[model samples]
Target: MFQSFTPLNDKVRLCQGCDLPIRVQQELPYGKNAYCPRCGTQLSRGGSPSLSGNLALAITCLLLFIPAFIFPFISIHLLGVTFSATVPEGAWNLMSHGFPLLSLLVLFCSVIAPIVLCAALVVCHLALHKHWFTGMKLGTTIIYRLKPWAMIDVFLVSVAVACFKLKDYSDIIVGPALYALIVLQLLSVLLISRVSLRRYWEAWRPEHTFEHQSKERHCIYCHLSQPVGTHCQRCHQPLHHRKPRSLERTLAYLLAASLAIFPANLIPISILITNGQRLEDTIYSGVISLFNSQMPGIAIIIFVASILVPMAKILGLGYLLVCAHWRKERFQRQRMKIYFVVKVIGKWSMLDLFVISIMLTLVDRGQILDFVPGIGAIAFGLVVFLTLLATESLDSRLLWDNHPNSPTSGRSINER
Candidate 1:
């Protein structure tokens, strides 16, 4: 039900989602947005092209990042003993407990990625604003590459889930770091949403109208239109009609995720030793335990984020690959929608991993109460990371390439 816009001039953009060319005005009116008429990928959002606002927000986040990780995030009290946990402490504890992969995953997603994003933004915007061309491209590229991995908001949600799971057995104390983290999460979200590689590129150099040609490539990284078989003039990445070896790479990641997911769900993800008794919980059993503890809502949240989201990504990506490989043109729009959902939800699957990290820090009171990450946590974390890679590697544009009615087929797909 999308309305098509007529191409008014030679100013064209390739929709990253659907791989169709969209003719658009060079700049949109303030506060308006443009979407792909065929598949609904946002092509442009209206706003000032200024870099100062983004620079300010990025600097603020960098300033706040210290206290958010250094101070105690939360305190747990059980049986007259109080223990506090910080973000860095949780990661270090996981590493010390021999789950180095899990610890690094938590540290990167919660600490390192956000810091990189903020630091990159600060450098990129400052370079662009001051006309320092030396590091602008590299800085901007890093920002886009690392933005999806920055999960401050998701980590905050995991914090709440961890508290919910522990409240029944322990008194929880919210700490100053938690408040700072909340603000950091909010600012991070705002800064990430406002950033666009396309806009930044345009700010650095205004878009130029290029002649339409039979062999043209649109740079996915910087959204530049250039000749096929040449590197993008803006970002300098090699251009391709479609992602080279897109199907093969997608299938590989999906197959690996498929193999890892079974052990992830069936094996114990967490272990609790309390009162001289040992208890291990698989993903399924953990959800059941939450339900039995009368926290059905948190159970459902964990179920969807941990169990269902991974399955959906694998199944959904597998189906899309099959269709795209066979040139099955039916339901291309629906498939695009599925791709978007899979991409967006892939990060949430790490919620369980983050929760495990938090629990490891909160409940290590020696023999009285202790939590350990089980073998399944590593597999689950791998599954999440692999699925994220699969989603990123799969080029959605490939689905439209072989369709006879698509724009690539010499038919104007946007025409009514």
Candidate 2:
């Protein structure tokens, strides 16, 4: 059941690339892209979206997620002993082993968030072009907000990497859940992204057009349109054209993460105890060990996730902040592109942390191969968390404010 929200007099949009607010002109034909006149960013490509297709993918993803939870993901056999754990089982094991925080983190990233995200999309797509369910707007808003927190793909990669790491000393078997998890990744992506911008605009139902001076507002959280100072009629969140305290909060987070990266890199992330021989591994030593172990691919993955990503993110955000503060209108589009890349990869940088968590949970059996968490683990995790907050705190709208034509660009984008 779906229902429409309050009617509007203007179709206000915040550019995904530049955040410049403007009215949608006549709907373009399917497959044609409309670029922003101010920043040359492709605003939207016209198309008739298949709500049915999205619904099918969401349903399929839900089916697969069930098996991904039930089937044992990995079996490691050593001597005469065999141990296996499913996704939720692993989280429970982590909790039973006294790491409740990591357990909750694993459960949310792999299970709860993915399920809610897919379920939300199904509801939103079913409610498309008309609202019948009071939860449509709330559900859709949750999908957008939860997408980043769903780490099924990253968790799958971690599981695969864990199996490979265990293969040297133990018999390794990938279970049915891993396969289901893989396919779920593909379909779940469609569930998350298949809904077109055109469908969102149409379903939300703003007025067909309006004067450039109408002073409309767009919700940053839900992307719903409203007039200035009014609550978002759809999602009920207070309206802010851009994130509040955007630049100041972003800079604060950037500085804090910068302080953290040094110790996070310099200290051991986890300690290894094999047959009672103790070894400490800094992040660099771990990557070096992976290379020495002839697992260059895994080593490269760890290096990128642990070393390169954080450094790049720190530098990238600092550069974007400096450019914004300096009002260097040059390369506005390029800056926006950089911002997007940094934001997307911020979560993936947690791959090392996930790997450590998995090993800590699974390998604590009588020192055959035991892994224990280290102090630097906290520092490293903070770096990842802070960078994520920094990215969210940034307001892309600031990028266009200094442009020479930005003042008149809203009206100009209407024609383009």
Candidate 3:
């Protein structure tokens, strides 16, 4: 039922390494790699079902999406009076306090984004099941479009920070809903990974069936038939072989984030004083006080999320860039592990921001022990924001794309 298509200048190419004539076979399966028999250089194939897994992930995300929205994310207790707020409640509280901008941000990140992402996933999955490829394509497109909105990781970190900030003023209790929200966020991430579009598309396209008969030349490294001796643009070497920049870009971002972390921690996220005259502290000071107050467990968490995690991310990304540039192949595998950790943990830096928002919304003492955002909070927020951008901007494929034997010049052959 398929038609044979041919390139205008089809030709048989000789492998530079092996000097063997190369044949262009018609209809290679999508994502399958081939190589020269003599030198074992790679070849490229494309086309796969892009929407199937993403559709399933979207559906599952919808199931978890409900509890995340309805549950109370946190509870606050002050002066023996307890108050609770869900994601929406927190936003409203921010708005009521004349911090409309903060409220809107809270609403968007904590509530709206997660919900929309779940909905988009469900739509994409359903389209794929019906064999509506166009619909599936649109769904995948929407999924990418909505990915930035799923900020549950950010929200969760914020919740942790908020809990730390509230410890001194009165008894703080983490609500059931807050735990549920965390679970939902995790599930959402899992769903996104499961439905990776690239994997699916590589499997769905039709295979080619015809073979080219003209004389041609193929790269010695990657076995693609080139017009003659041409270099792979991605690897920037002579056409004979393939393999694979900027430490400066990574370092620039790391330095920027590091500079921002100072203000983020110094900013007065919230102040608590026993009976209005005992103590005042920002997030950093509060963590110290927590340790001093014999609460080492909470102190450790604060130290990790607020201090260690962010620094590790910056340092880790920097290291990955440096190592990759230097071609330190011994620890090459370690780079992948580090990249995964950085991507996963970068959002947690926003925990401080979440805590500040929650504290400002939950605690109000009419100037007795007021909660006002410090300049450091804004700086810290910028640091987290920029760092997340930096992490995303980094191309993880760089870690694996440089193998001398990789096909398509190490450009991802799969288009899913």
Candidate 4:
């Protein structure tokens, strides 16, 4: 049975400031702070302005969320006839076109997910506003659940693709909803950056007091707080204040993702035929053709989603991992930064996947021009999937080893 620590122990080995248990021992030269093993309550800590900033941004985002959904995202003009799509309209269009799967995908990615995410943020803000620190556990869980499903960025990529592909046939106009969507995305990022969970935990620990007693402090992992301990049962390490393997694993995943990217992009993604003429298009070629056909805006989008964004994800993850591995990085504060970047950018790589799905459904005009996904589509999908996995595998805690007062639990290194 799993057990968490409590203040009930008679011989309390309290955290220096908070009077909570020293969950684990600290290594020398770092002077790590001890924490309550169960609740992760810090013994002593200082407040940060970031918490207030995060709350403000979260509230602002909630206000923007309404307009983002209520307005039309894009308008299409075909030979003096005009059609516009709200997020839901786009879904209906796909469904009416006999692409039910793609329709649902669009609806969920563009509409449902964004709404849920914003709502979760609002709830979190309210909880924080009410000073209900205990409620934050639930709010954080909701936010984490919403993270993967919030696909506004991915939807933006799809819209850009659609704009490019449709440009040759019609006039495309951006709408209020599109700008709202952009603002919503920006606000979400700001909210994520402004909050630091660790710092929050430190500041809002449950009010409790424990009297310090003189007994040997036991390690949470090894069950032995004896001086000069050897290994921990949790992490199974000669205990150090920092995670040893986090940097290496992060770097390895980053490098692997970088290596796989070349093949993913260089390959041909689709073959398009117009007027009974066959034309092979790589990802770049397809975007070029879109621009040559007077869809520069769409071309820019394609380049961003299919090429630049994914590369940025790989490079950013790589840089963070390398920095963490060197021990030169300040892990605690920066850990959230790395985590936010990875979580937010992970789904954007699905842009190519969305493009493939859309093209497969929309370009089947029987006798005029036919489009079929090529090898590049499959490869690109795999790369995106793998990179997402790599991002998930990275441990954000690796960045905090240098913190002067980190917790001592063997489990601390493992905590997200």
Candidate 5:
């Protein structure tokens, strides 16, 4: 029911996805969506955040967050013995068993990072509502940085895989923490979706006095517009229209990740030693084993998480780089869409590492059933990390830019 925002500064909006700058369109009174013309990405949903409403969800998220770790996550009964684990216990178990680095990775990505994300959203939303403008900017930047790394969703998937893997051998019982995690993850997703960043940008929108658009350098990370070569006023980061060295860094990471993939696949990732019988698994062989065990659901998930995601990320990034380097302007939306998907789903390849962590904690039966990390697991982890870096560095806007006939070509980017 809100009218179109008309700022006194005549602020120009840049598409975060495709980088095409455009005027804001008024939403249809019927509540139809407003979208970027160049890329058809959603600009707004014809409404703003209900500060109190979302703040309550944020509070609820924080409330549920602890229960997700405090209660038992899963209980396993095998061979007349019972084992159980809580959320924090899993990572600490890893640390106690000689995987200190992995302990940190899991603890940070799964627990601390997500908690900080929820808290940051709370601060940002509260700051916006209270007219605490600078804190809002700072909190928004923190959310953006932590957004990808706060991987509760990935950890949840790992939990599911662990359950599937052990179900055949153990009587798997779901715990209250699992339910709590589900609700917490769901709430976090909803809270993020409910955020209207357009509102925040408008709150921080500058009354630009620059005579020309080229003189307006915008920091892509925080969307702060400023004079060229100076630090951002709000985020204090460097200002640039295009991401710095987007292509060069992407290529470097892509090549390094590709080199690691060979050893990652050729070597065994993990070994299962049960009752003196040894079974080794490469990434593909693990998938095959899952399939052979009649656990096709788990098999498909592992295949997608471990194999398809990395390939999609690497190949999709490679294609984007090639298209950008060649200045191929055809299908700009499709390329940008591919880039968007890669940026999101690519990081989930870390699900494999998460699964490793959970298994290492949950499946140690001492001579009966012990899980050992192989050298290949290390290499595979490198591939996941490197490809994630590559995809993140590959700016999607490059897919739309540098084109001879593109709308952005020969235009003053700083102009309103």
Candidate 6:
């Protein structure tokens, strides 16, 4: 009953990564994958990806959510006093401290986004399974949009870092919720990677497969070739040759991130007061402090995720933007590689923020050992968010638009 979209031999599949139009095999063997000849982006993988299996995975994640977020996640014991908080409680702690923005951020990323992502996938697969097309499209959109922001895995990593940082001063207790969260994170990863968006689009409208001969126009989302200026029949997005205003938007985000990065690194991100003596730790100073505490490994991670990554994203995105704007052809492959790296590592930079959120809940004993967030935390969080936007807004296709050997280089505005 599950009919796969089998394209004609002459049909062209557009690479969403670099926008290269490639003529792929009509039916690839199971367990094999096709890669774009130019940019090496995975074009298609051969498998009977089941809708029911994906639905089951999503449902399991949804059920696991209660234990992952509701119950005690982690606890700390210091000075003969014990304090424990759930995932949501940590966010609430931040909100109670007047940092509502960061609190909302934690809630959105750790709670709302994951819930929405799982729910969306469940609905999408169910709609497709039941042949109910109406909600399928909306579900598909929500799933992809929420995937990046669902930082359950990142938050878990942050938990590990938090544990490491606090182990020296306190007895850290791992709760059942932490184990549930870990399991939830693993399942989420598998579900996301397993459910191919293109596969869904193909299954939704098998007739829209690349049956046409014209390579002039195509839909980047569903990869269906269509007439000029028409919306994609499958995904309903406008058929643009390139994402409109890609470079300009990328530049704006990068500029804003660049401005924020300074204050983020210069000012103290957190303040610690003990016995009425105060000490402030900037981003750099925090790394050094971690090193002084014999946590060189964590210090390096903090340095890379907090300090090095933000700077690299700004500089890397700027380089790509300049090259794309001027249509520079040399090292287009290398540029694409840089873009991929920037996109992947964008979320991990929030490690410090997550660490701070956990630390606040653990070390607030008032004058004996109080940890208060500083203005720099706000600026640093902004840098993470803005860079993520910059990475998403820039069209990778633009990088290939000016290459001499590029398939889409000659034509300025017609397809995909």
Judged by TM-score, which candidate is best? Answer: 1
lDDT of 6 by residue, 274-363 (tens): 768788999999999999999999999999999889999999999999998898978988998998898888888988898888888878
Candidate 1 Cα outliers beyond 4 Å, as residue runs: 1-9, 209-215, 405-416
lDDT for each residue of candidate 2 in 126-194, tens digit (9 for 90 to 100)? 665466455676666777677778887788788777766677867886778778988988777766656
Count of backbone collisions in candidate 6: 0
lDDT computed for candidate 3: 0.58
Which ranges in model 2 have alpha carbons more than 4 Å from their true place? 1-16, 21-30, 37-42, 96-98, 125-133, 196-198, 204-216, 221-227, 233-236, 406-416
lDDT by residue for model 5 over 234-283, one digit each (tens)?
55666666788999999999999889888988899888887788999999
TM-score of 5: 0.86
Over 4 Å off, model 6: 1-10, 207-211, 365-367, 405-416
Best by lDDT: 1
User: How far does residue 92 in candidate 3 sit from its true spot (Å)?
Assistant: 5.4
How far is each candidate from the true structure, as Cα RMSD in Å? Answer: 3.3, 5.0, 9.4, 10.3, 5.0, 4.9
Q: Estimate every model's Cα lDDT from 0 to 1.
A: 0.83, 0.72, 0.58, 0.57, 0.74, 0.80
Residue 318 in model 2: lDDT: 98
Error of 2 at 277 (Å): 2.0
Better model by lDDT: candidate 2 vs candidate 5: 5
Full candidate order by lDDT, most accurate first: 1, 6, 5, 2, 3, 4
Better of 2 and 4 by TM-score: 2
Q: Give lDDT tens digits, candidate 4, residues 134-237.
A: 46555555665555656766767687776667666557878898898888888776665444443443344311232323322333322222222355322233
Candidate 4 clash pair list: 18-43, 33-405, 331-399, 331-400, 332-400
Q: Model 1 residue 172 lDDT?
A: 98
Model 4 gets an lDDT of: 0.57
Going through the candidates in the order shown, the clash numbers are: 0, 7, 30, 5, 2, 0
Which runs in model 5 stand beyond 4 Å of their true positions? 1-11, 26-31, 129-134, 204-216, 221-229, 233-236, 365-367, 405-416
Model 5: which ten-residue window has the lowest total lDDT?
Answer: 1-10
